[model samples]
Each structure stands twice: as C-alpha cells, then as structure tokens.
Target: MNYKDYYKIMAVDKTASQDEIKTSYRKLARKFHPDVSKEKDAETRFKDINEAYEVLRDKEKRAAYDQLGSNWKAGQSGFTPPPSWQDQYQQGNGNFNAGAGGQGDFSDFFESLFGGGFGGGQHAARGRRSMQGQDSNAKILIDLQDAYTGATRNFTLQDQVVDQQGRTQTKDRTLKVSIPKGIKPGQKIRLKKQGQAGVGGAPNGDLYLEVGFNPDSLYTIEGADITTELSISPWQAALGEKVKVPTPTGHIDLSLPKLISSGSKMRLKGRGLPCKVAGDFFVKLKIVFPKSLSTEEEALYQSLKALATNSDKNIEDEA
Candidate 1:
C-alpha cells in the first residue's frame, strides 16, 4: 500500500485547521465533480480529494495520520504504519462513511492506518521475523444486564480469506464470545487468531469486538451509571413515601422526599453497574395522577379549597 500525503492531496499545509481543510475540499469537489467538471480524471481526483479531506478533517484521524510524520512522501509505495499506531487507533468499521468518504471509498493507505477498511486491517508484517496477521475490529451489542453479569454469545463475522486463485474474499465465520463482567461501553474484547490466516505458519491476526449496549425498554446506561424511571402516585410524591422500584440488579425499597417533583432524580450510591469504582444508581420519579375524582373526594377537595382560601385572605388582612 502507498503512503497518501493527505495535506498534499488537498493542497493544504499539515497544520491547516478543520475549517480550512473543509474549504479546500469544497473547491476541489466542485472542480472535479463528475456530473459537472470537464476534467478528464475528474472522478478519480474527486475520490482522492474526498479521501484526503476524510483524514485531514477529523482531529483524531488527522492526528493518527500525522503520527506517520512528514518524512513519508505522498503516493510513496509500500508505506508501513508505525508500530504504536494500531494501539491508539483501533477504529471500528462500525462507521465507515461517517467521514468525508460518503461512499466508503478509501485507499489501502487509509485502510492500513485506520483499523476498519476493505483490507480487513491485515497489513503484512514486513519487518517482524514471525509474520503476525493483521487484527480486525467489529462491534457487538449486548444487554445492559450483561454489564452487571457477563454472558456468552455467538456472532457471525465477515472474514477475509485467500482462495485458490490468490484473491481475497469474504467468508462467514462464527465464534462464541464471552462478554466480561464490568465491561463498559466502547470497550473491546480481543479474540486470538479469529482474523486472517497467516502465511508460512506465522501467527494469525486477532479479532476485536467493540462492546455496545442494546437499547433497553426500562433502563439506559451511561458509563458505569444506570438510570430507570420510578413511577409513584401524586399523593406519594407530595407526602414522600417508600416504594418498591425495579433496578437492573433487583427490586429495592427507595425512599421518596416530600413534595418530590415529577422527573426529579434520587440516587443510590453503589447501586449502578459493577466496576472498579462502582457507578451509582439513579431513580427518576414520574408522578401519576388519577384520571377521575370520586364524588366524596370532590366534596373533600372543596372543603380543603375553602380552608386554603380563608388562609390566603387572613394573610391579605395582616398585610
């Protein structure tokens, strides 16, 4: 794979700001837009411009690219990424087109630097004695309960395989994965040798599964903390009462403050997802009022209204 000088591609300095980079992209895009441009290689130039903007526009991707340093010339063949680059940027293919490449059109150079791309993140281990297959990344959605108590699940992944014709092709591969307890969102699980096969009995690349929580009907997770709505009657909210509320862990009696407002939150420390620090549990109050009033209840409400009116009039008299 060749090294792509993103700055050179966009005709901008390496230190150009995001706004400047975007401005350059617009100009180049308009000049090379296949639909309107008269340039001979408009489409190819447009894709290159888009690819350059894709890397240079984002702070993280740009920073990762810059780490290769200015020593590498643009379009230089067989550009090898630095050793520590992968450790920092295990970017998942989960969002391919979120960047400037709207069509998932990126060069092998882009794919080699960024973990997720058509290359399956397996660049040849050119320098190492024992060839190590390139590691690949994919995302997995697990239940919030799995965070508290881990569970094992099976997943089907698209893996790159070399056929008899010496061509790379995708094949469906299944593997059972164990979701660890206390694993937070955005964390990754590394499964050994689950990726591309290595040549000459070299070590196979590993597969990384990025962890994500499935949307739950009753709960939402952020970091180690978890939140759930606790329903209570208007009277209970007004007078403060102990109520049984459901949590991810289990049911617990939660005390409500007097005159608690609807949507107000009460927190129970250490009741959230288990971790090194243990996130706190939060209960959001939802006050429900009866749709109808009984005849006797209406009569009692009238009496209370009279008393409240008299009290207001007394205050006015005193003033």
Candidate 2:
C-alpha cells in the first residue's frame, strides 16, 4: 500500500493545534467541495480533505498515524506498516471508529489501517448476529416562505454501503418529503427506515434532517416573530398616514402614529408565521429623505427654517 501523509495533505505542521488543523481542513474542504467548486479535480481533492480530517480529528487515529514516523513520504509505493503494527493495533491500543457514515470516502490505506472490525479493532469471538443499520443525519435548506406555509420538497440523499465483498460504495436515493408549516430552523424531521440498509434483513436505520432557512432579503426571522424594514418620507413621520405594509400572509394597511421616529416599530398582531400560536409581524420605520431636492422643494425647506428662526427670536425677546 502507498503511504499517505495526512498532515501534508491538510497543509499543517506536525505541531499544529487542533483548532489550526480544523481551520485548514474547513478552508480546503470549501475550496474543493464538488457542488460549489469549479476546479476540475474538486471531487478528488474533496475526498482527500475529508480523509485527512477524519484521521487527524481523532486522537487515537492521530496517535497511530504519528507512530508511522517521517521516514515514509506520501505516495511512496509498496510501503507497508511495521511488522509489529498490526499486533499493537489488535491489542486495543489504536481502536477507533468513524462517526456515523463518515468512513465512506476514506482511502484503501486508511481502511487497511483502521477499518478492520467492530470499533475498528479485531472482531469479537462471539457468534455473529444480524444488526440494525446505523442512523444518518443531514441538513436541508428551505425558503422562509416554506415555513409560513406547508410545502412538498424533493431531496436526493447520498448513502454509503458496504457490499458483500467488503467494498464501500455510494448510493443515491431520492425522497419526496412534506414540510409541515411552522417548522422552525434547527428543528429536525425524522424519516423512518430511510437510512443505510440493515444487515441480514434487520430493520433499516432512520434519517434525521435538520431544517435551516435560506437568507431572505425582505425579512428577518426571530423565533416566531418576523421583522421587516418600512421606508417612509420625513413628512410621513411628522404627519401620520395610513400606509400599506407587506406581511407574510399579505399586505395590510398600517396607521403610522404622528411624530413617529426612525427605528420605531409597529406591531401587526397575528400576522407573522402561521404556527400553533400565530406570531406578530413587526415593521421597523425608516425615515428616508429624497436623494436630491428640486428648486421648489428647497424653497419650502427655507421657509420652514425662517419660521423656526423667528420663533426662537421671539422667545429670546420675551425673556
């Protein structure tokens, strides 16, 4: 097997801290993520980054890898572990298991070193029995409007499975899911029997999807409350008026109280998200001045300034 230098792959020094290693791994992972990256070799690079992180992130795996020493370089062909390495690992000194289905994209070298049996150690001597598959977790992004109203969503989930020949393979499965109204961010929806296939006809594992919201340009969601900016002219603040304000359900006429200041908020009862208990919609007033004033508009502003000056002089004379 070829030797793999995980530290070199992550571009981190041997003495790098865990936080430093994580930062580097995340940066490289984003740069090579297949869905977003335009690089030709993004898939391969992404796999490499994941493999490196899987090993280095675990203390047992890192210790085992560090024992391999600096004599062997990455990509060196026909390199094998020391004669006593297997014996040492079998003694329970380097037992490690990947988190959930995170072991899928690892390399042959990693599998040989750490993917032997249950818990990545030698198999137990007890008789084998059918076992249920492991549960899987994933995050799904939805529009803010979807949370306001129930919607149907389609998702393609990628799963990893070990074949009869003990080779890991990836399978894609599509599912149509119904998103219930009032589902908030960080809430999870569970789909039963949708995870990895069970061994020996045992029941399949469950899939848990954590919900997240896509950023909305019009509104900011806070818990059940929704806030939006309402732009109004200076005269509208000085003299109250009824204005049409947009809400999640629809637009409603809002009465702007006289002498309302910029950054003042108006509440629309039961007009936010359609949850078990409806949330309030808030409109934060923003006083906007005209970008440029016409000659006629400028004269009006001058007249107001003279009136204010005359009123101040009259007060001084009375004093």
Candidate 3:
C-alpha cells in the first residue's frame, strides 16, 4: 500500500486554516459525491475526498497525519509505514468511528495513523503500535562570518526508511537550516519533525545540529570571544603606527603602541558577538623581519649593531 497525503487529496495547503480546509472539502465532496456527479471515477474520488476530510477536520488527527510529512503524494504506490509501526494512536476506549456524514470507510493510511482496533466497540487491538520517534543529532560546520552575521546553510543526510517490501533502505534527505547570529561553537539548533518518523502517527522526533566553526587560519572563536593574529613589521613594533587590520566583519585602522612587543594584545570591547553582553575581540601582535635584506637595509642594521657594541664597551669601562 502507498502512503497517502490527506492535504493533497483535500486540495489545500498544509498551512490552510481549518475553515479554509472545511470550505474546500465541501466543494470537492459535492462535486464527486457519486450520486449527482458525472465526473469519471466519481465513486472512488468521493470516498477518497471524504476520507481526507475526516482526518483533516479533526485537529489531533490532522496533526498526527502531518507527522508523515508531505512527501507521500497521492497516486504514489509501493510504500507503507515502517515495520515497527504499532496500533496506539486511538487511546483508551476512544475510537476512530467518525467519517464524513457520519459514514464512510477510511483508508489503510488513516487506519495506520489512527487505530482501526475497534470492531463493534469490542477490544480488537490488531496491528502495530505507535510511539514518538527517536531524536537525532548531527554536527554542522559554519564560517566565521556566519558567527558574526546570521546565515543559512544546507546539509544532506542519509535516512533509513522501510519500503513496501519490508526492507530498510537509505534515502538522501536535504535540509536548509538557519544559523543565528552570535551562535558559538558546540551550540545546537533544534529542528522539529525532521528526524525519524513516529510509528503509527506519533509525531516524529526532533533533529539537533551542533554548530562548529569551519577551519580558518586567520581567526578563532572561544565562547563569545573572537581572536585573530595581526602580523606587523619590526619597525612598526618599535615606532608604532596606524595599520589596517582585518576583523570578522571587516577591516579597521588600529594604532600600535610604541615599543610594543610581539604577543601584545589589543582588544575591541563589545565587538565579539551576541550584540548584548558581547564578548571582546582580541588582536595579538606578531612582530617579524625580512628573511633577506637589501644592501642599504643591511648597512643600516650593521651600523646599529656597531653602535650597540661601542655603548656596551663604554658602560663596561665606566664600571
């Protein structure tokens, strides 16, 4: 048997209001009521329409049917609920006897979601049971800019489903997720009904995505704090000057203190993230020299070395 999409059968969007659903169902039902309609397949269409209306009109039943997802299209075959499906949706003595006009046979799909376990109101619990699906988790890597500014990301996964032949198969499922601004590594985002489908109409489990930063050589994030290294020339460290530095959001001019040493840090308060209780952005200085110097540059360094040597000798003699 194939999974049926009640929303498609009712010719209404899944988001349609209950009144809208009822209005559409009436029009469709009257057109193919099998008594006054001349449309082909009127009898079959009438039953199908009524069946869909019965489920959609009830809030709890509609919500449970929605757990099956909209992927199950009308006229599609060779699909059924998982083998683990059980009969448990109709609780206590509650029964699914309601149908359009108080009379109409329900489909197997409906029975699966709502138990068909009542025969003349006697206890006839025959079929698989129902329960909430197991929650699932995954890790997602995002860019540094994503942390600074909210962004969207897409991910694909292999999910297990039972085919009509009672065998489990893997299918590729893609999801587009939103990454909120100021989200830190190790944080998780919850997606409802994106995990394993609940058995026999129980709501599907939630999916949680743990966020992490994509590998970047220039910057790193810890908690809400952001840190990056700024390379500077030896002269810039000694003389101090304004330099353009790269930040997560953009570049900005930063002044270095004179005689600043390598590993010295400069901080931008409330620039890290969250936009409230914001962390600080730290720029660590790294002073470096040219591997090969020009002749004039080499001469300047040589003179400085000689002057340093003379000064040390004079100090020693004075002592």
Candidate 4:
C-alpha cells in the first residue's frame, strides 16, 4: 500500500495537542465528508483522511509509526535491504513482535522487510497435528508515547531447524510491522503467511504477536482511562489554585479544588485513549510537605499549630 502522510492529511503538526488533532480532524472531516462535499473522488480522499487520522490520532499506533524513522519516502524506488537485515534493524525495546506483520494484508515490500508469511490453503488442512511444523510466536513492548500516537516497528525473528544430518541450526529473519493506535497490553497481532514454511506446501501456521508496555509511563492505564499521581504542596491543596499537571497528552494547567486533601482525585473528561467516546484522565493528588522549613515558615506553622486542636473527649472527661 502507498504510504499516507497522516500528519499532512489531518493538516496538523506531528506535535499537535490531542485537542488540536481532534479539531483538525473535525474540520477536514466536514470539508471532505461524503455527505456534504461536492468534490469528485471526495469519498476516496475522505476515507484516506479518516484512515490516516485513525492511525495518527492514536498513541500506540503513532508511536509505532515514529519508530520507522522519516527516511523512507512514500513510493521511492531503488530499495535494497542488506543481509541479516532483520537482526540489524529489529526493534525490541518495548517487546514488539516482528512476527505479527506476517498475518497482515501488506505489500511485498513490507513482507520482504519483515520476512514471514501465512500458510496457504493446503497448509491449513494439515492442522496442528503436523509433526514437523511448529507454530511461531513473538512479543513486542511499546512506549506510552507510541501507544498514544501509533507507531511502526521493525524486528527480526530466528527459528532453529534440524536438518537431515541430525544437526540443529538457526535461521534468522526480520520484518517491519505497524502497530495500531490505542492498542492495549495483552493484545496480539497476527501476521498471515508469516511463519515457518509448511512441509510439501501443506501450509504454514499463523504468527502471533503479544503486545506489552514499557516502564516510565507518565500515566498508568486502567481499561480505557489513564491515571497519574500528581504531587502538590500543602498550600496549593489548602488554597485552590491552578497548577501545571502532566498527562500522556502533555502538561496542562489544572484547576484544583480548594478543599482537596492528600489522596484526593480529579478527572479530565474525554482526555484518555481516542476511542469513540474517548476515555477520561484521572489525577490522584499527593500532598507534599516541605522539608527544613525556614524561620518565617516555622513561625507560620507554629501559629497554625497553636490554633489547631485535636479533640480527645474520653481523656478530657477522665481528667
């Protein structure tokens, strides 16, 4: 398939905010919306735009795309890959399984880069009972950014085979795969015809890829929504004020409640994954105390302590 510039189609910067992306999508979607547009080929162009937006607007998919780098121009010819190319360029940083690309409906270029294929009609009949052939599996880990923005990845897979000589050997291969936006952990990608060759053309089993997330994620995902702990000083929580809080989408000014206490939770509506209705972003408050208070600060604390009292009715009555 021809490469589609999702950023260009949406008319937004690659670094555009989630809100900006949404806004750009809405505007373009309206302009090219099949129902309202009068331009010829509007339907096809609109679909392309929608598809591009679908991939670019999502975090996971976008991240995969970013990993592919910006060197390859769409439809540029004179392409040649090196020997043991899969090992040299395979991306395993976030547990991205290169084998998953085998099952997808990709072009020869993509298949050659990744190096696997699904079984043919003849092979499917052999079933799992086929003694010689073994099913292949792979796993890929992706960063939180890639999950939010979508991404393309490259990887290499190796399989060991025992020849008629009774000696075991390893064969290495590689591939490029696209990870869709917003794909969650534990999800698997299947690549057709991207596995070990079937015996006597019996057909090959499908390659399965398991998805995982990396550490150091700014927000922790729970289902559709994302959660993050935000640290605030005691004064900020006691007196409601605007503070910059970090989210997967980036930092934004948040208006905290004046009465918020440590462990209090706040939510940003419709700011999580880019699903149909979209998910929410939840911020859990963590109040921090300043260490080594200054003399002025100590005076203020002492005054406040003098005015604060804890009731001990039982002890008081006994006394």
Index of the highest-TM-score prediction: 3
RMSD of each: 13.3, 9.5, 16.6, 22.3
Q: Write the per-residue lDDT of candidate 1 for residues 1-319, one digit (tens) a residue.
A: 7777779889899778888887787678768966457899998997788777766766666775686765345465777776655655654433332233332345667656754541233322221112234466799899998889988989888765667986667888888999988888999999999765553356676888999999998988899998998779977997898899888877988888899899999999998888888999888889887888999988987997999899999999999
lDDT per residue for candidate 2 within 1-319, as digits (tens), equals 7888889989999999999998897688658866557999998887777778877887877887897755334467887766776777644542465432232346778766665552643232110123344466788888888889889999887766557986667878888888999987788999998865654455777889998888988899887789999999988998999888887667889889998999999888887878888888899999999999999999999998999899999999999
What do the candidate models score in CA lDDT, each in turn?
0.74, 0.76, 0.74, 0.64
Question: Model 2: what TM-score?
Answer: 0.58
Q: Higher-TM-score candidate among 1 and 4?
A: 1
Question: Candidate 4 at 83: error in angstroms?
Answer: 59
Worst 10 residues of 3 by lDDT: 119-128
Q: For candidate 3, what is the lDDT?
A: 0.74
Off by over 4 Å in 1: 1-130, 160-162, 165-170
Residue 107's lDDT within candidate 4 is: 37
Which scores greater on TM-score, model 3 or model 4? 3
Residues 30-131, model 3: lDDT tens digits: 688554578999978877876787678877667656765543344568666644334444444254534422124556766665545332232223212333
Give the lDDT of residue 4 in candidate 2.
Answer: 82
**Clashing pairs in model 1?**
none
Candidate 4, residues 1-319: lDDT per residue as tens digits?
4455567878888888878987776577657855457889876676665555545655654575555435455445655444444554443333332222112133344334432322322232232122112246788787767777888888677766667885667877777878878777788888876765554334675778888877765678775688889889988998999999887777999999897889888988988776555788899999999878999999999887765533455567779
- Which is superior by lDDT, 2 or 3? 2
Model 4, CA-based lDDT: 0.64
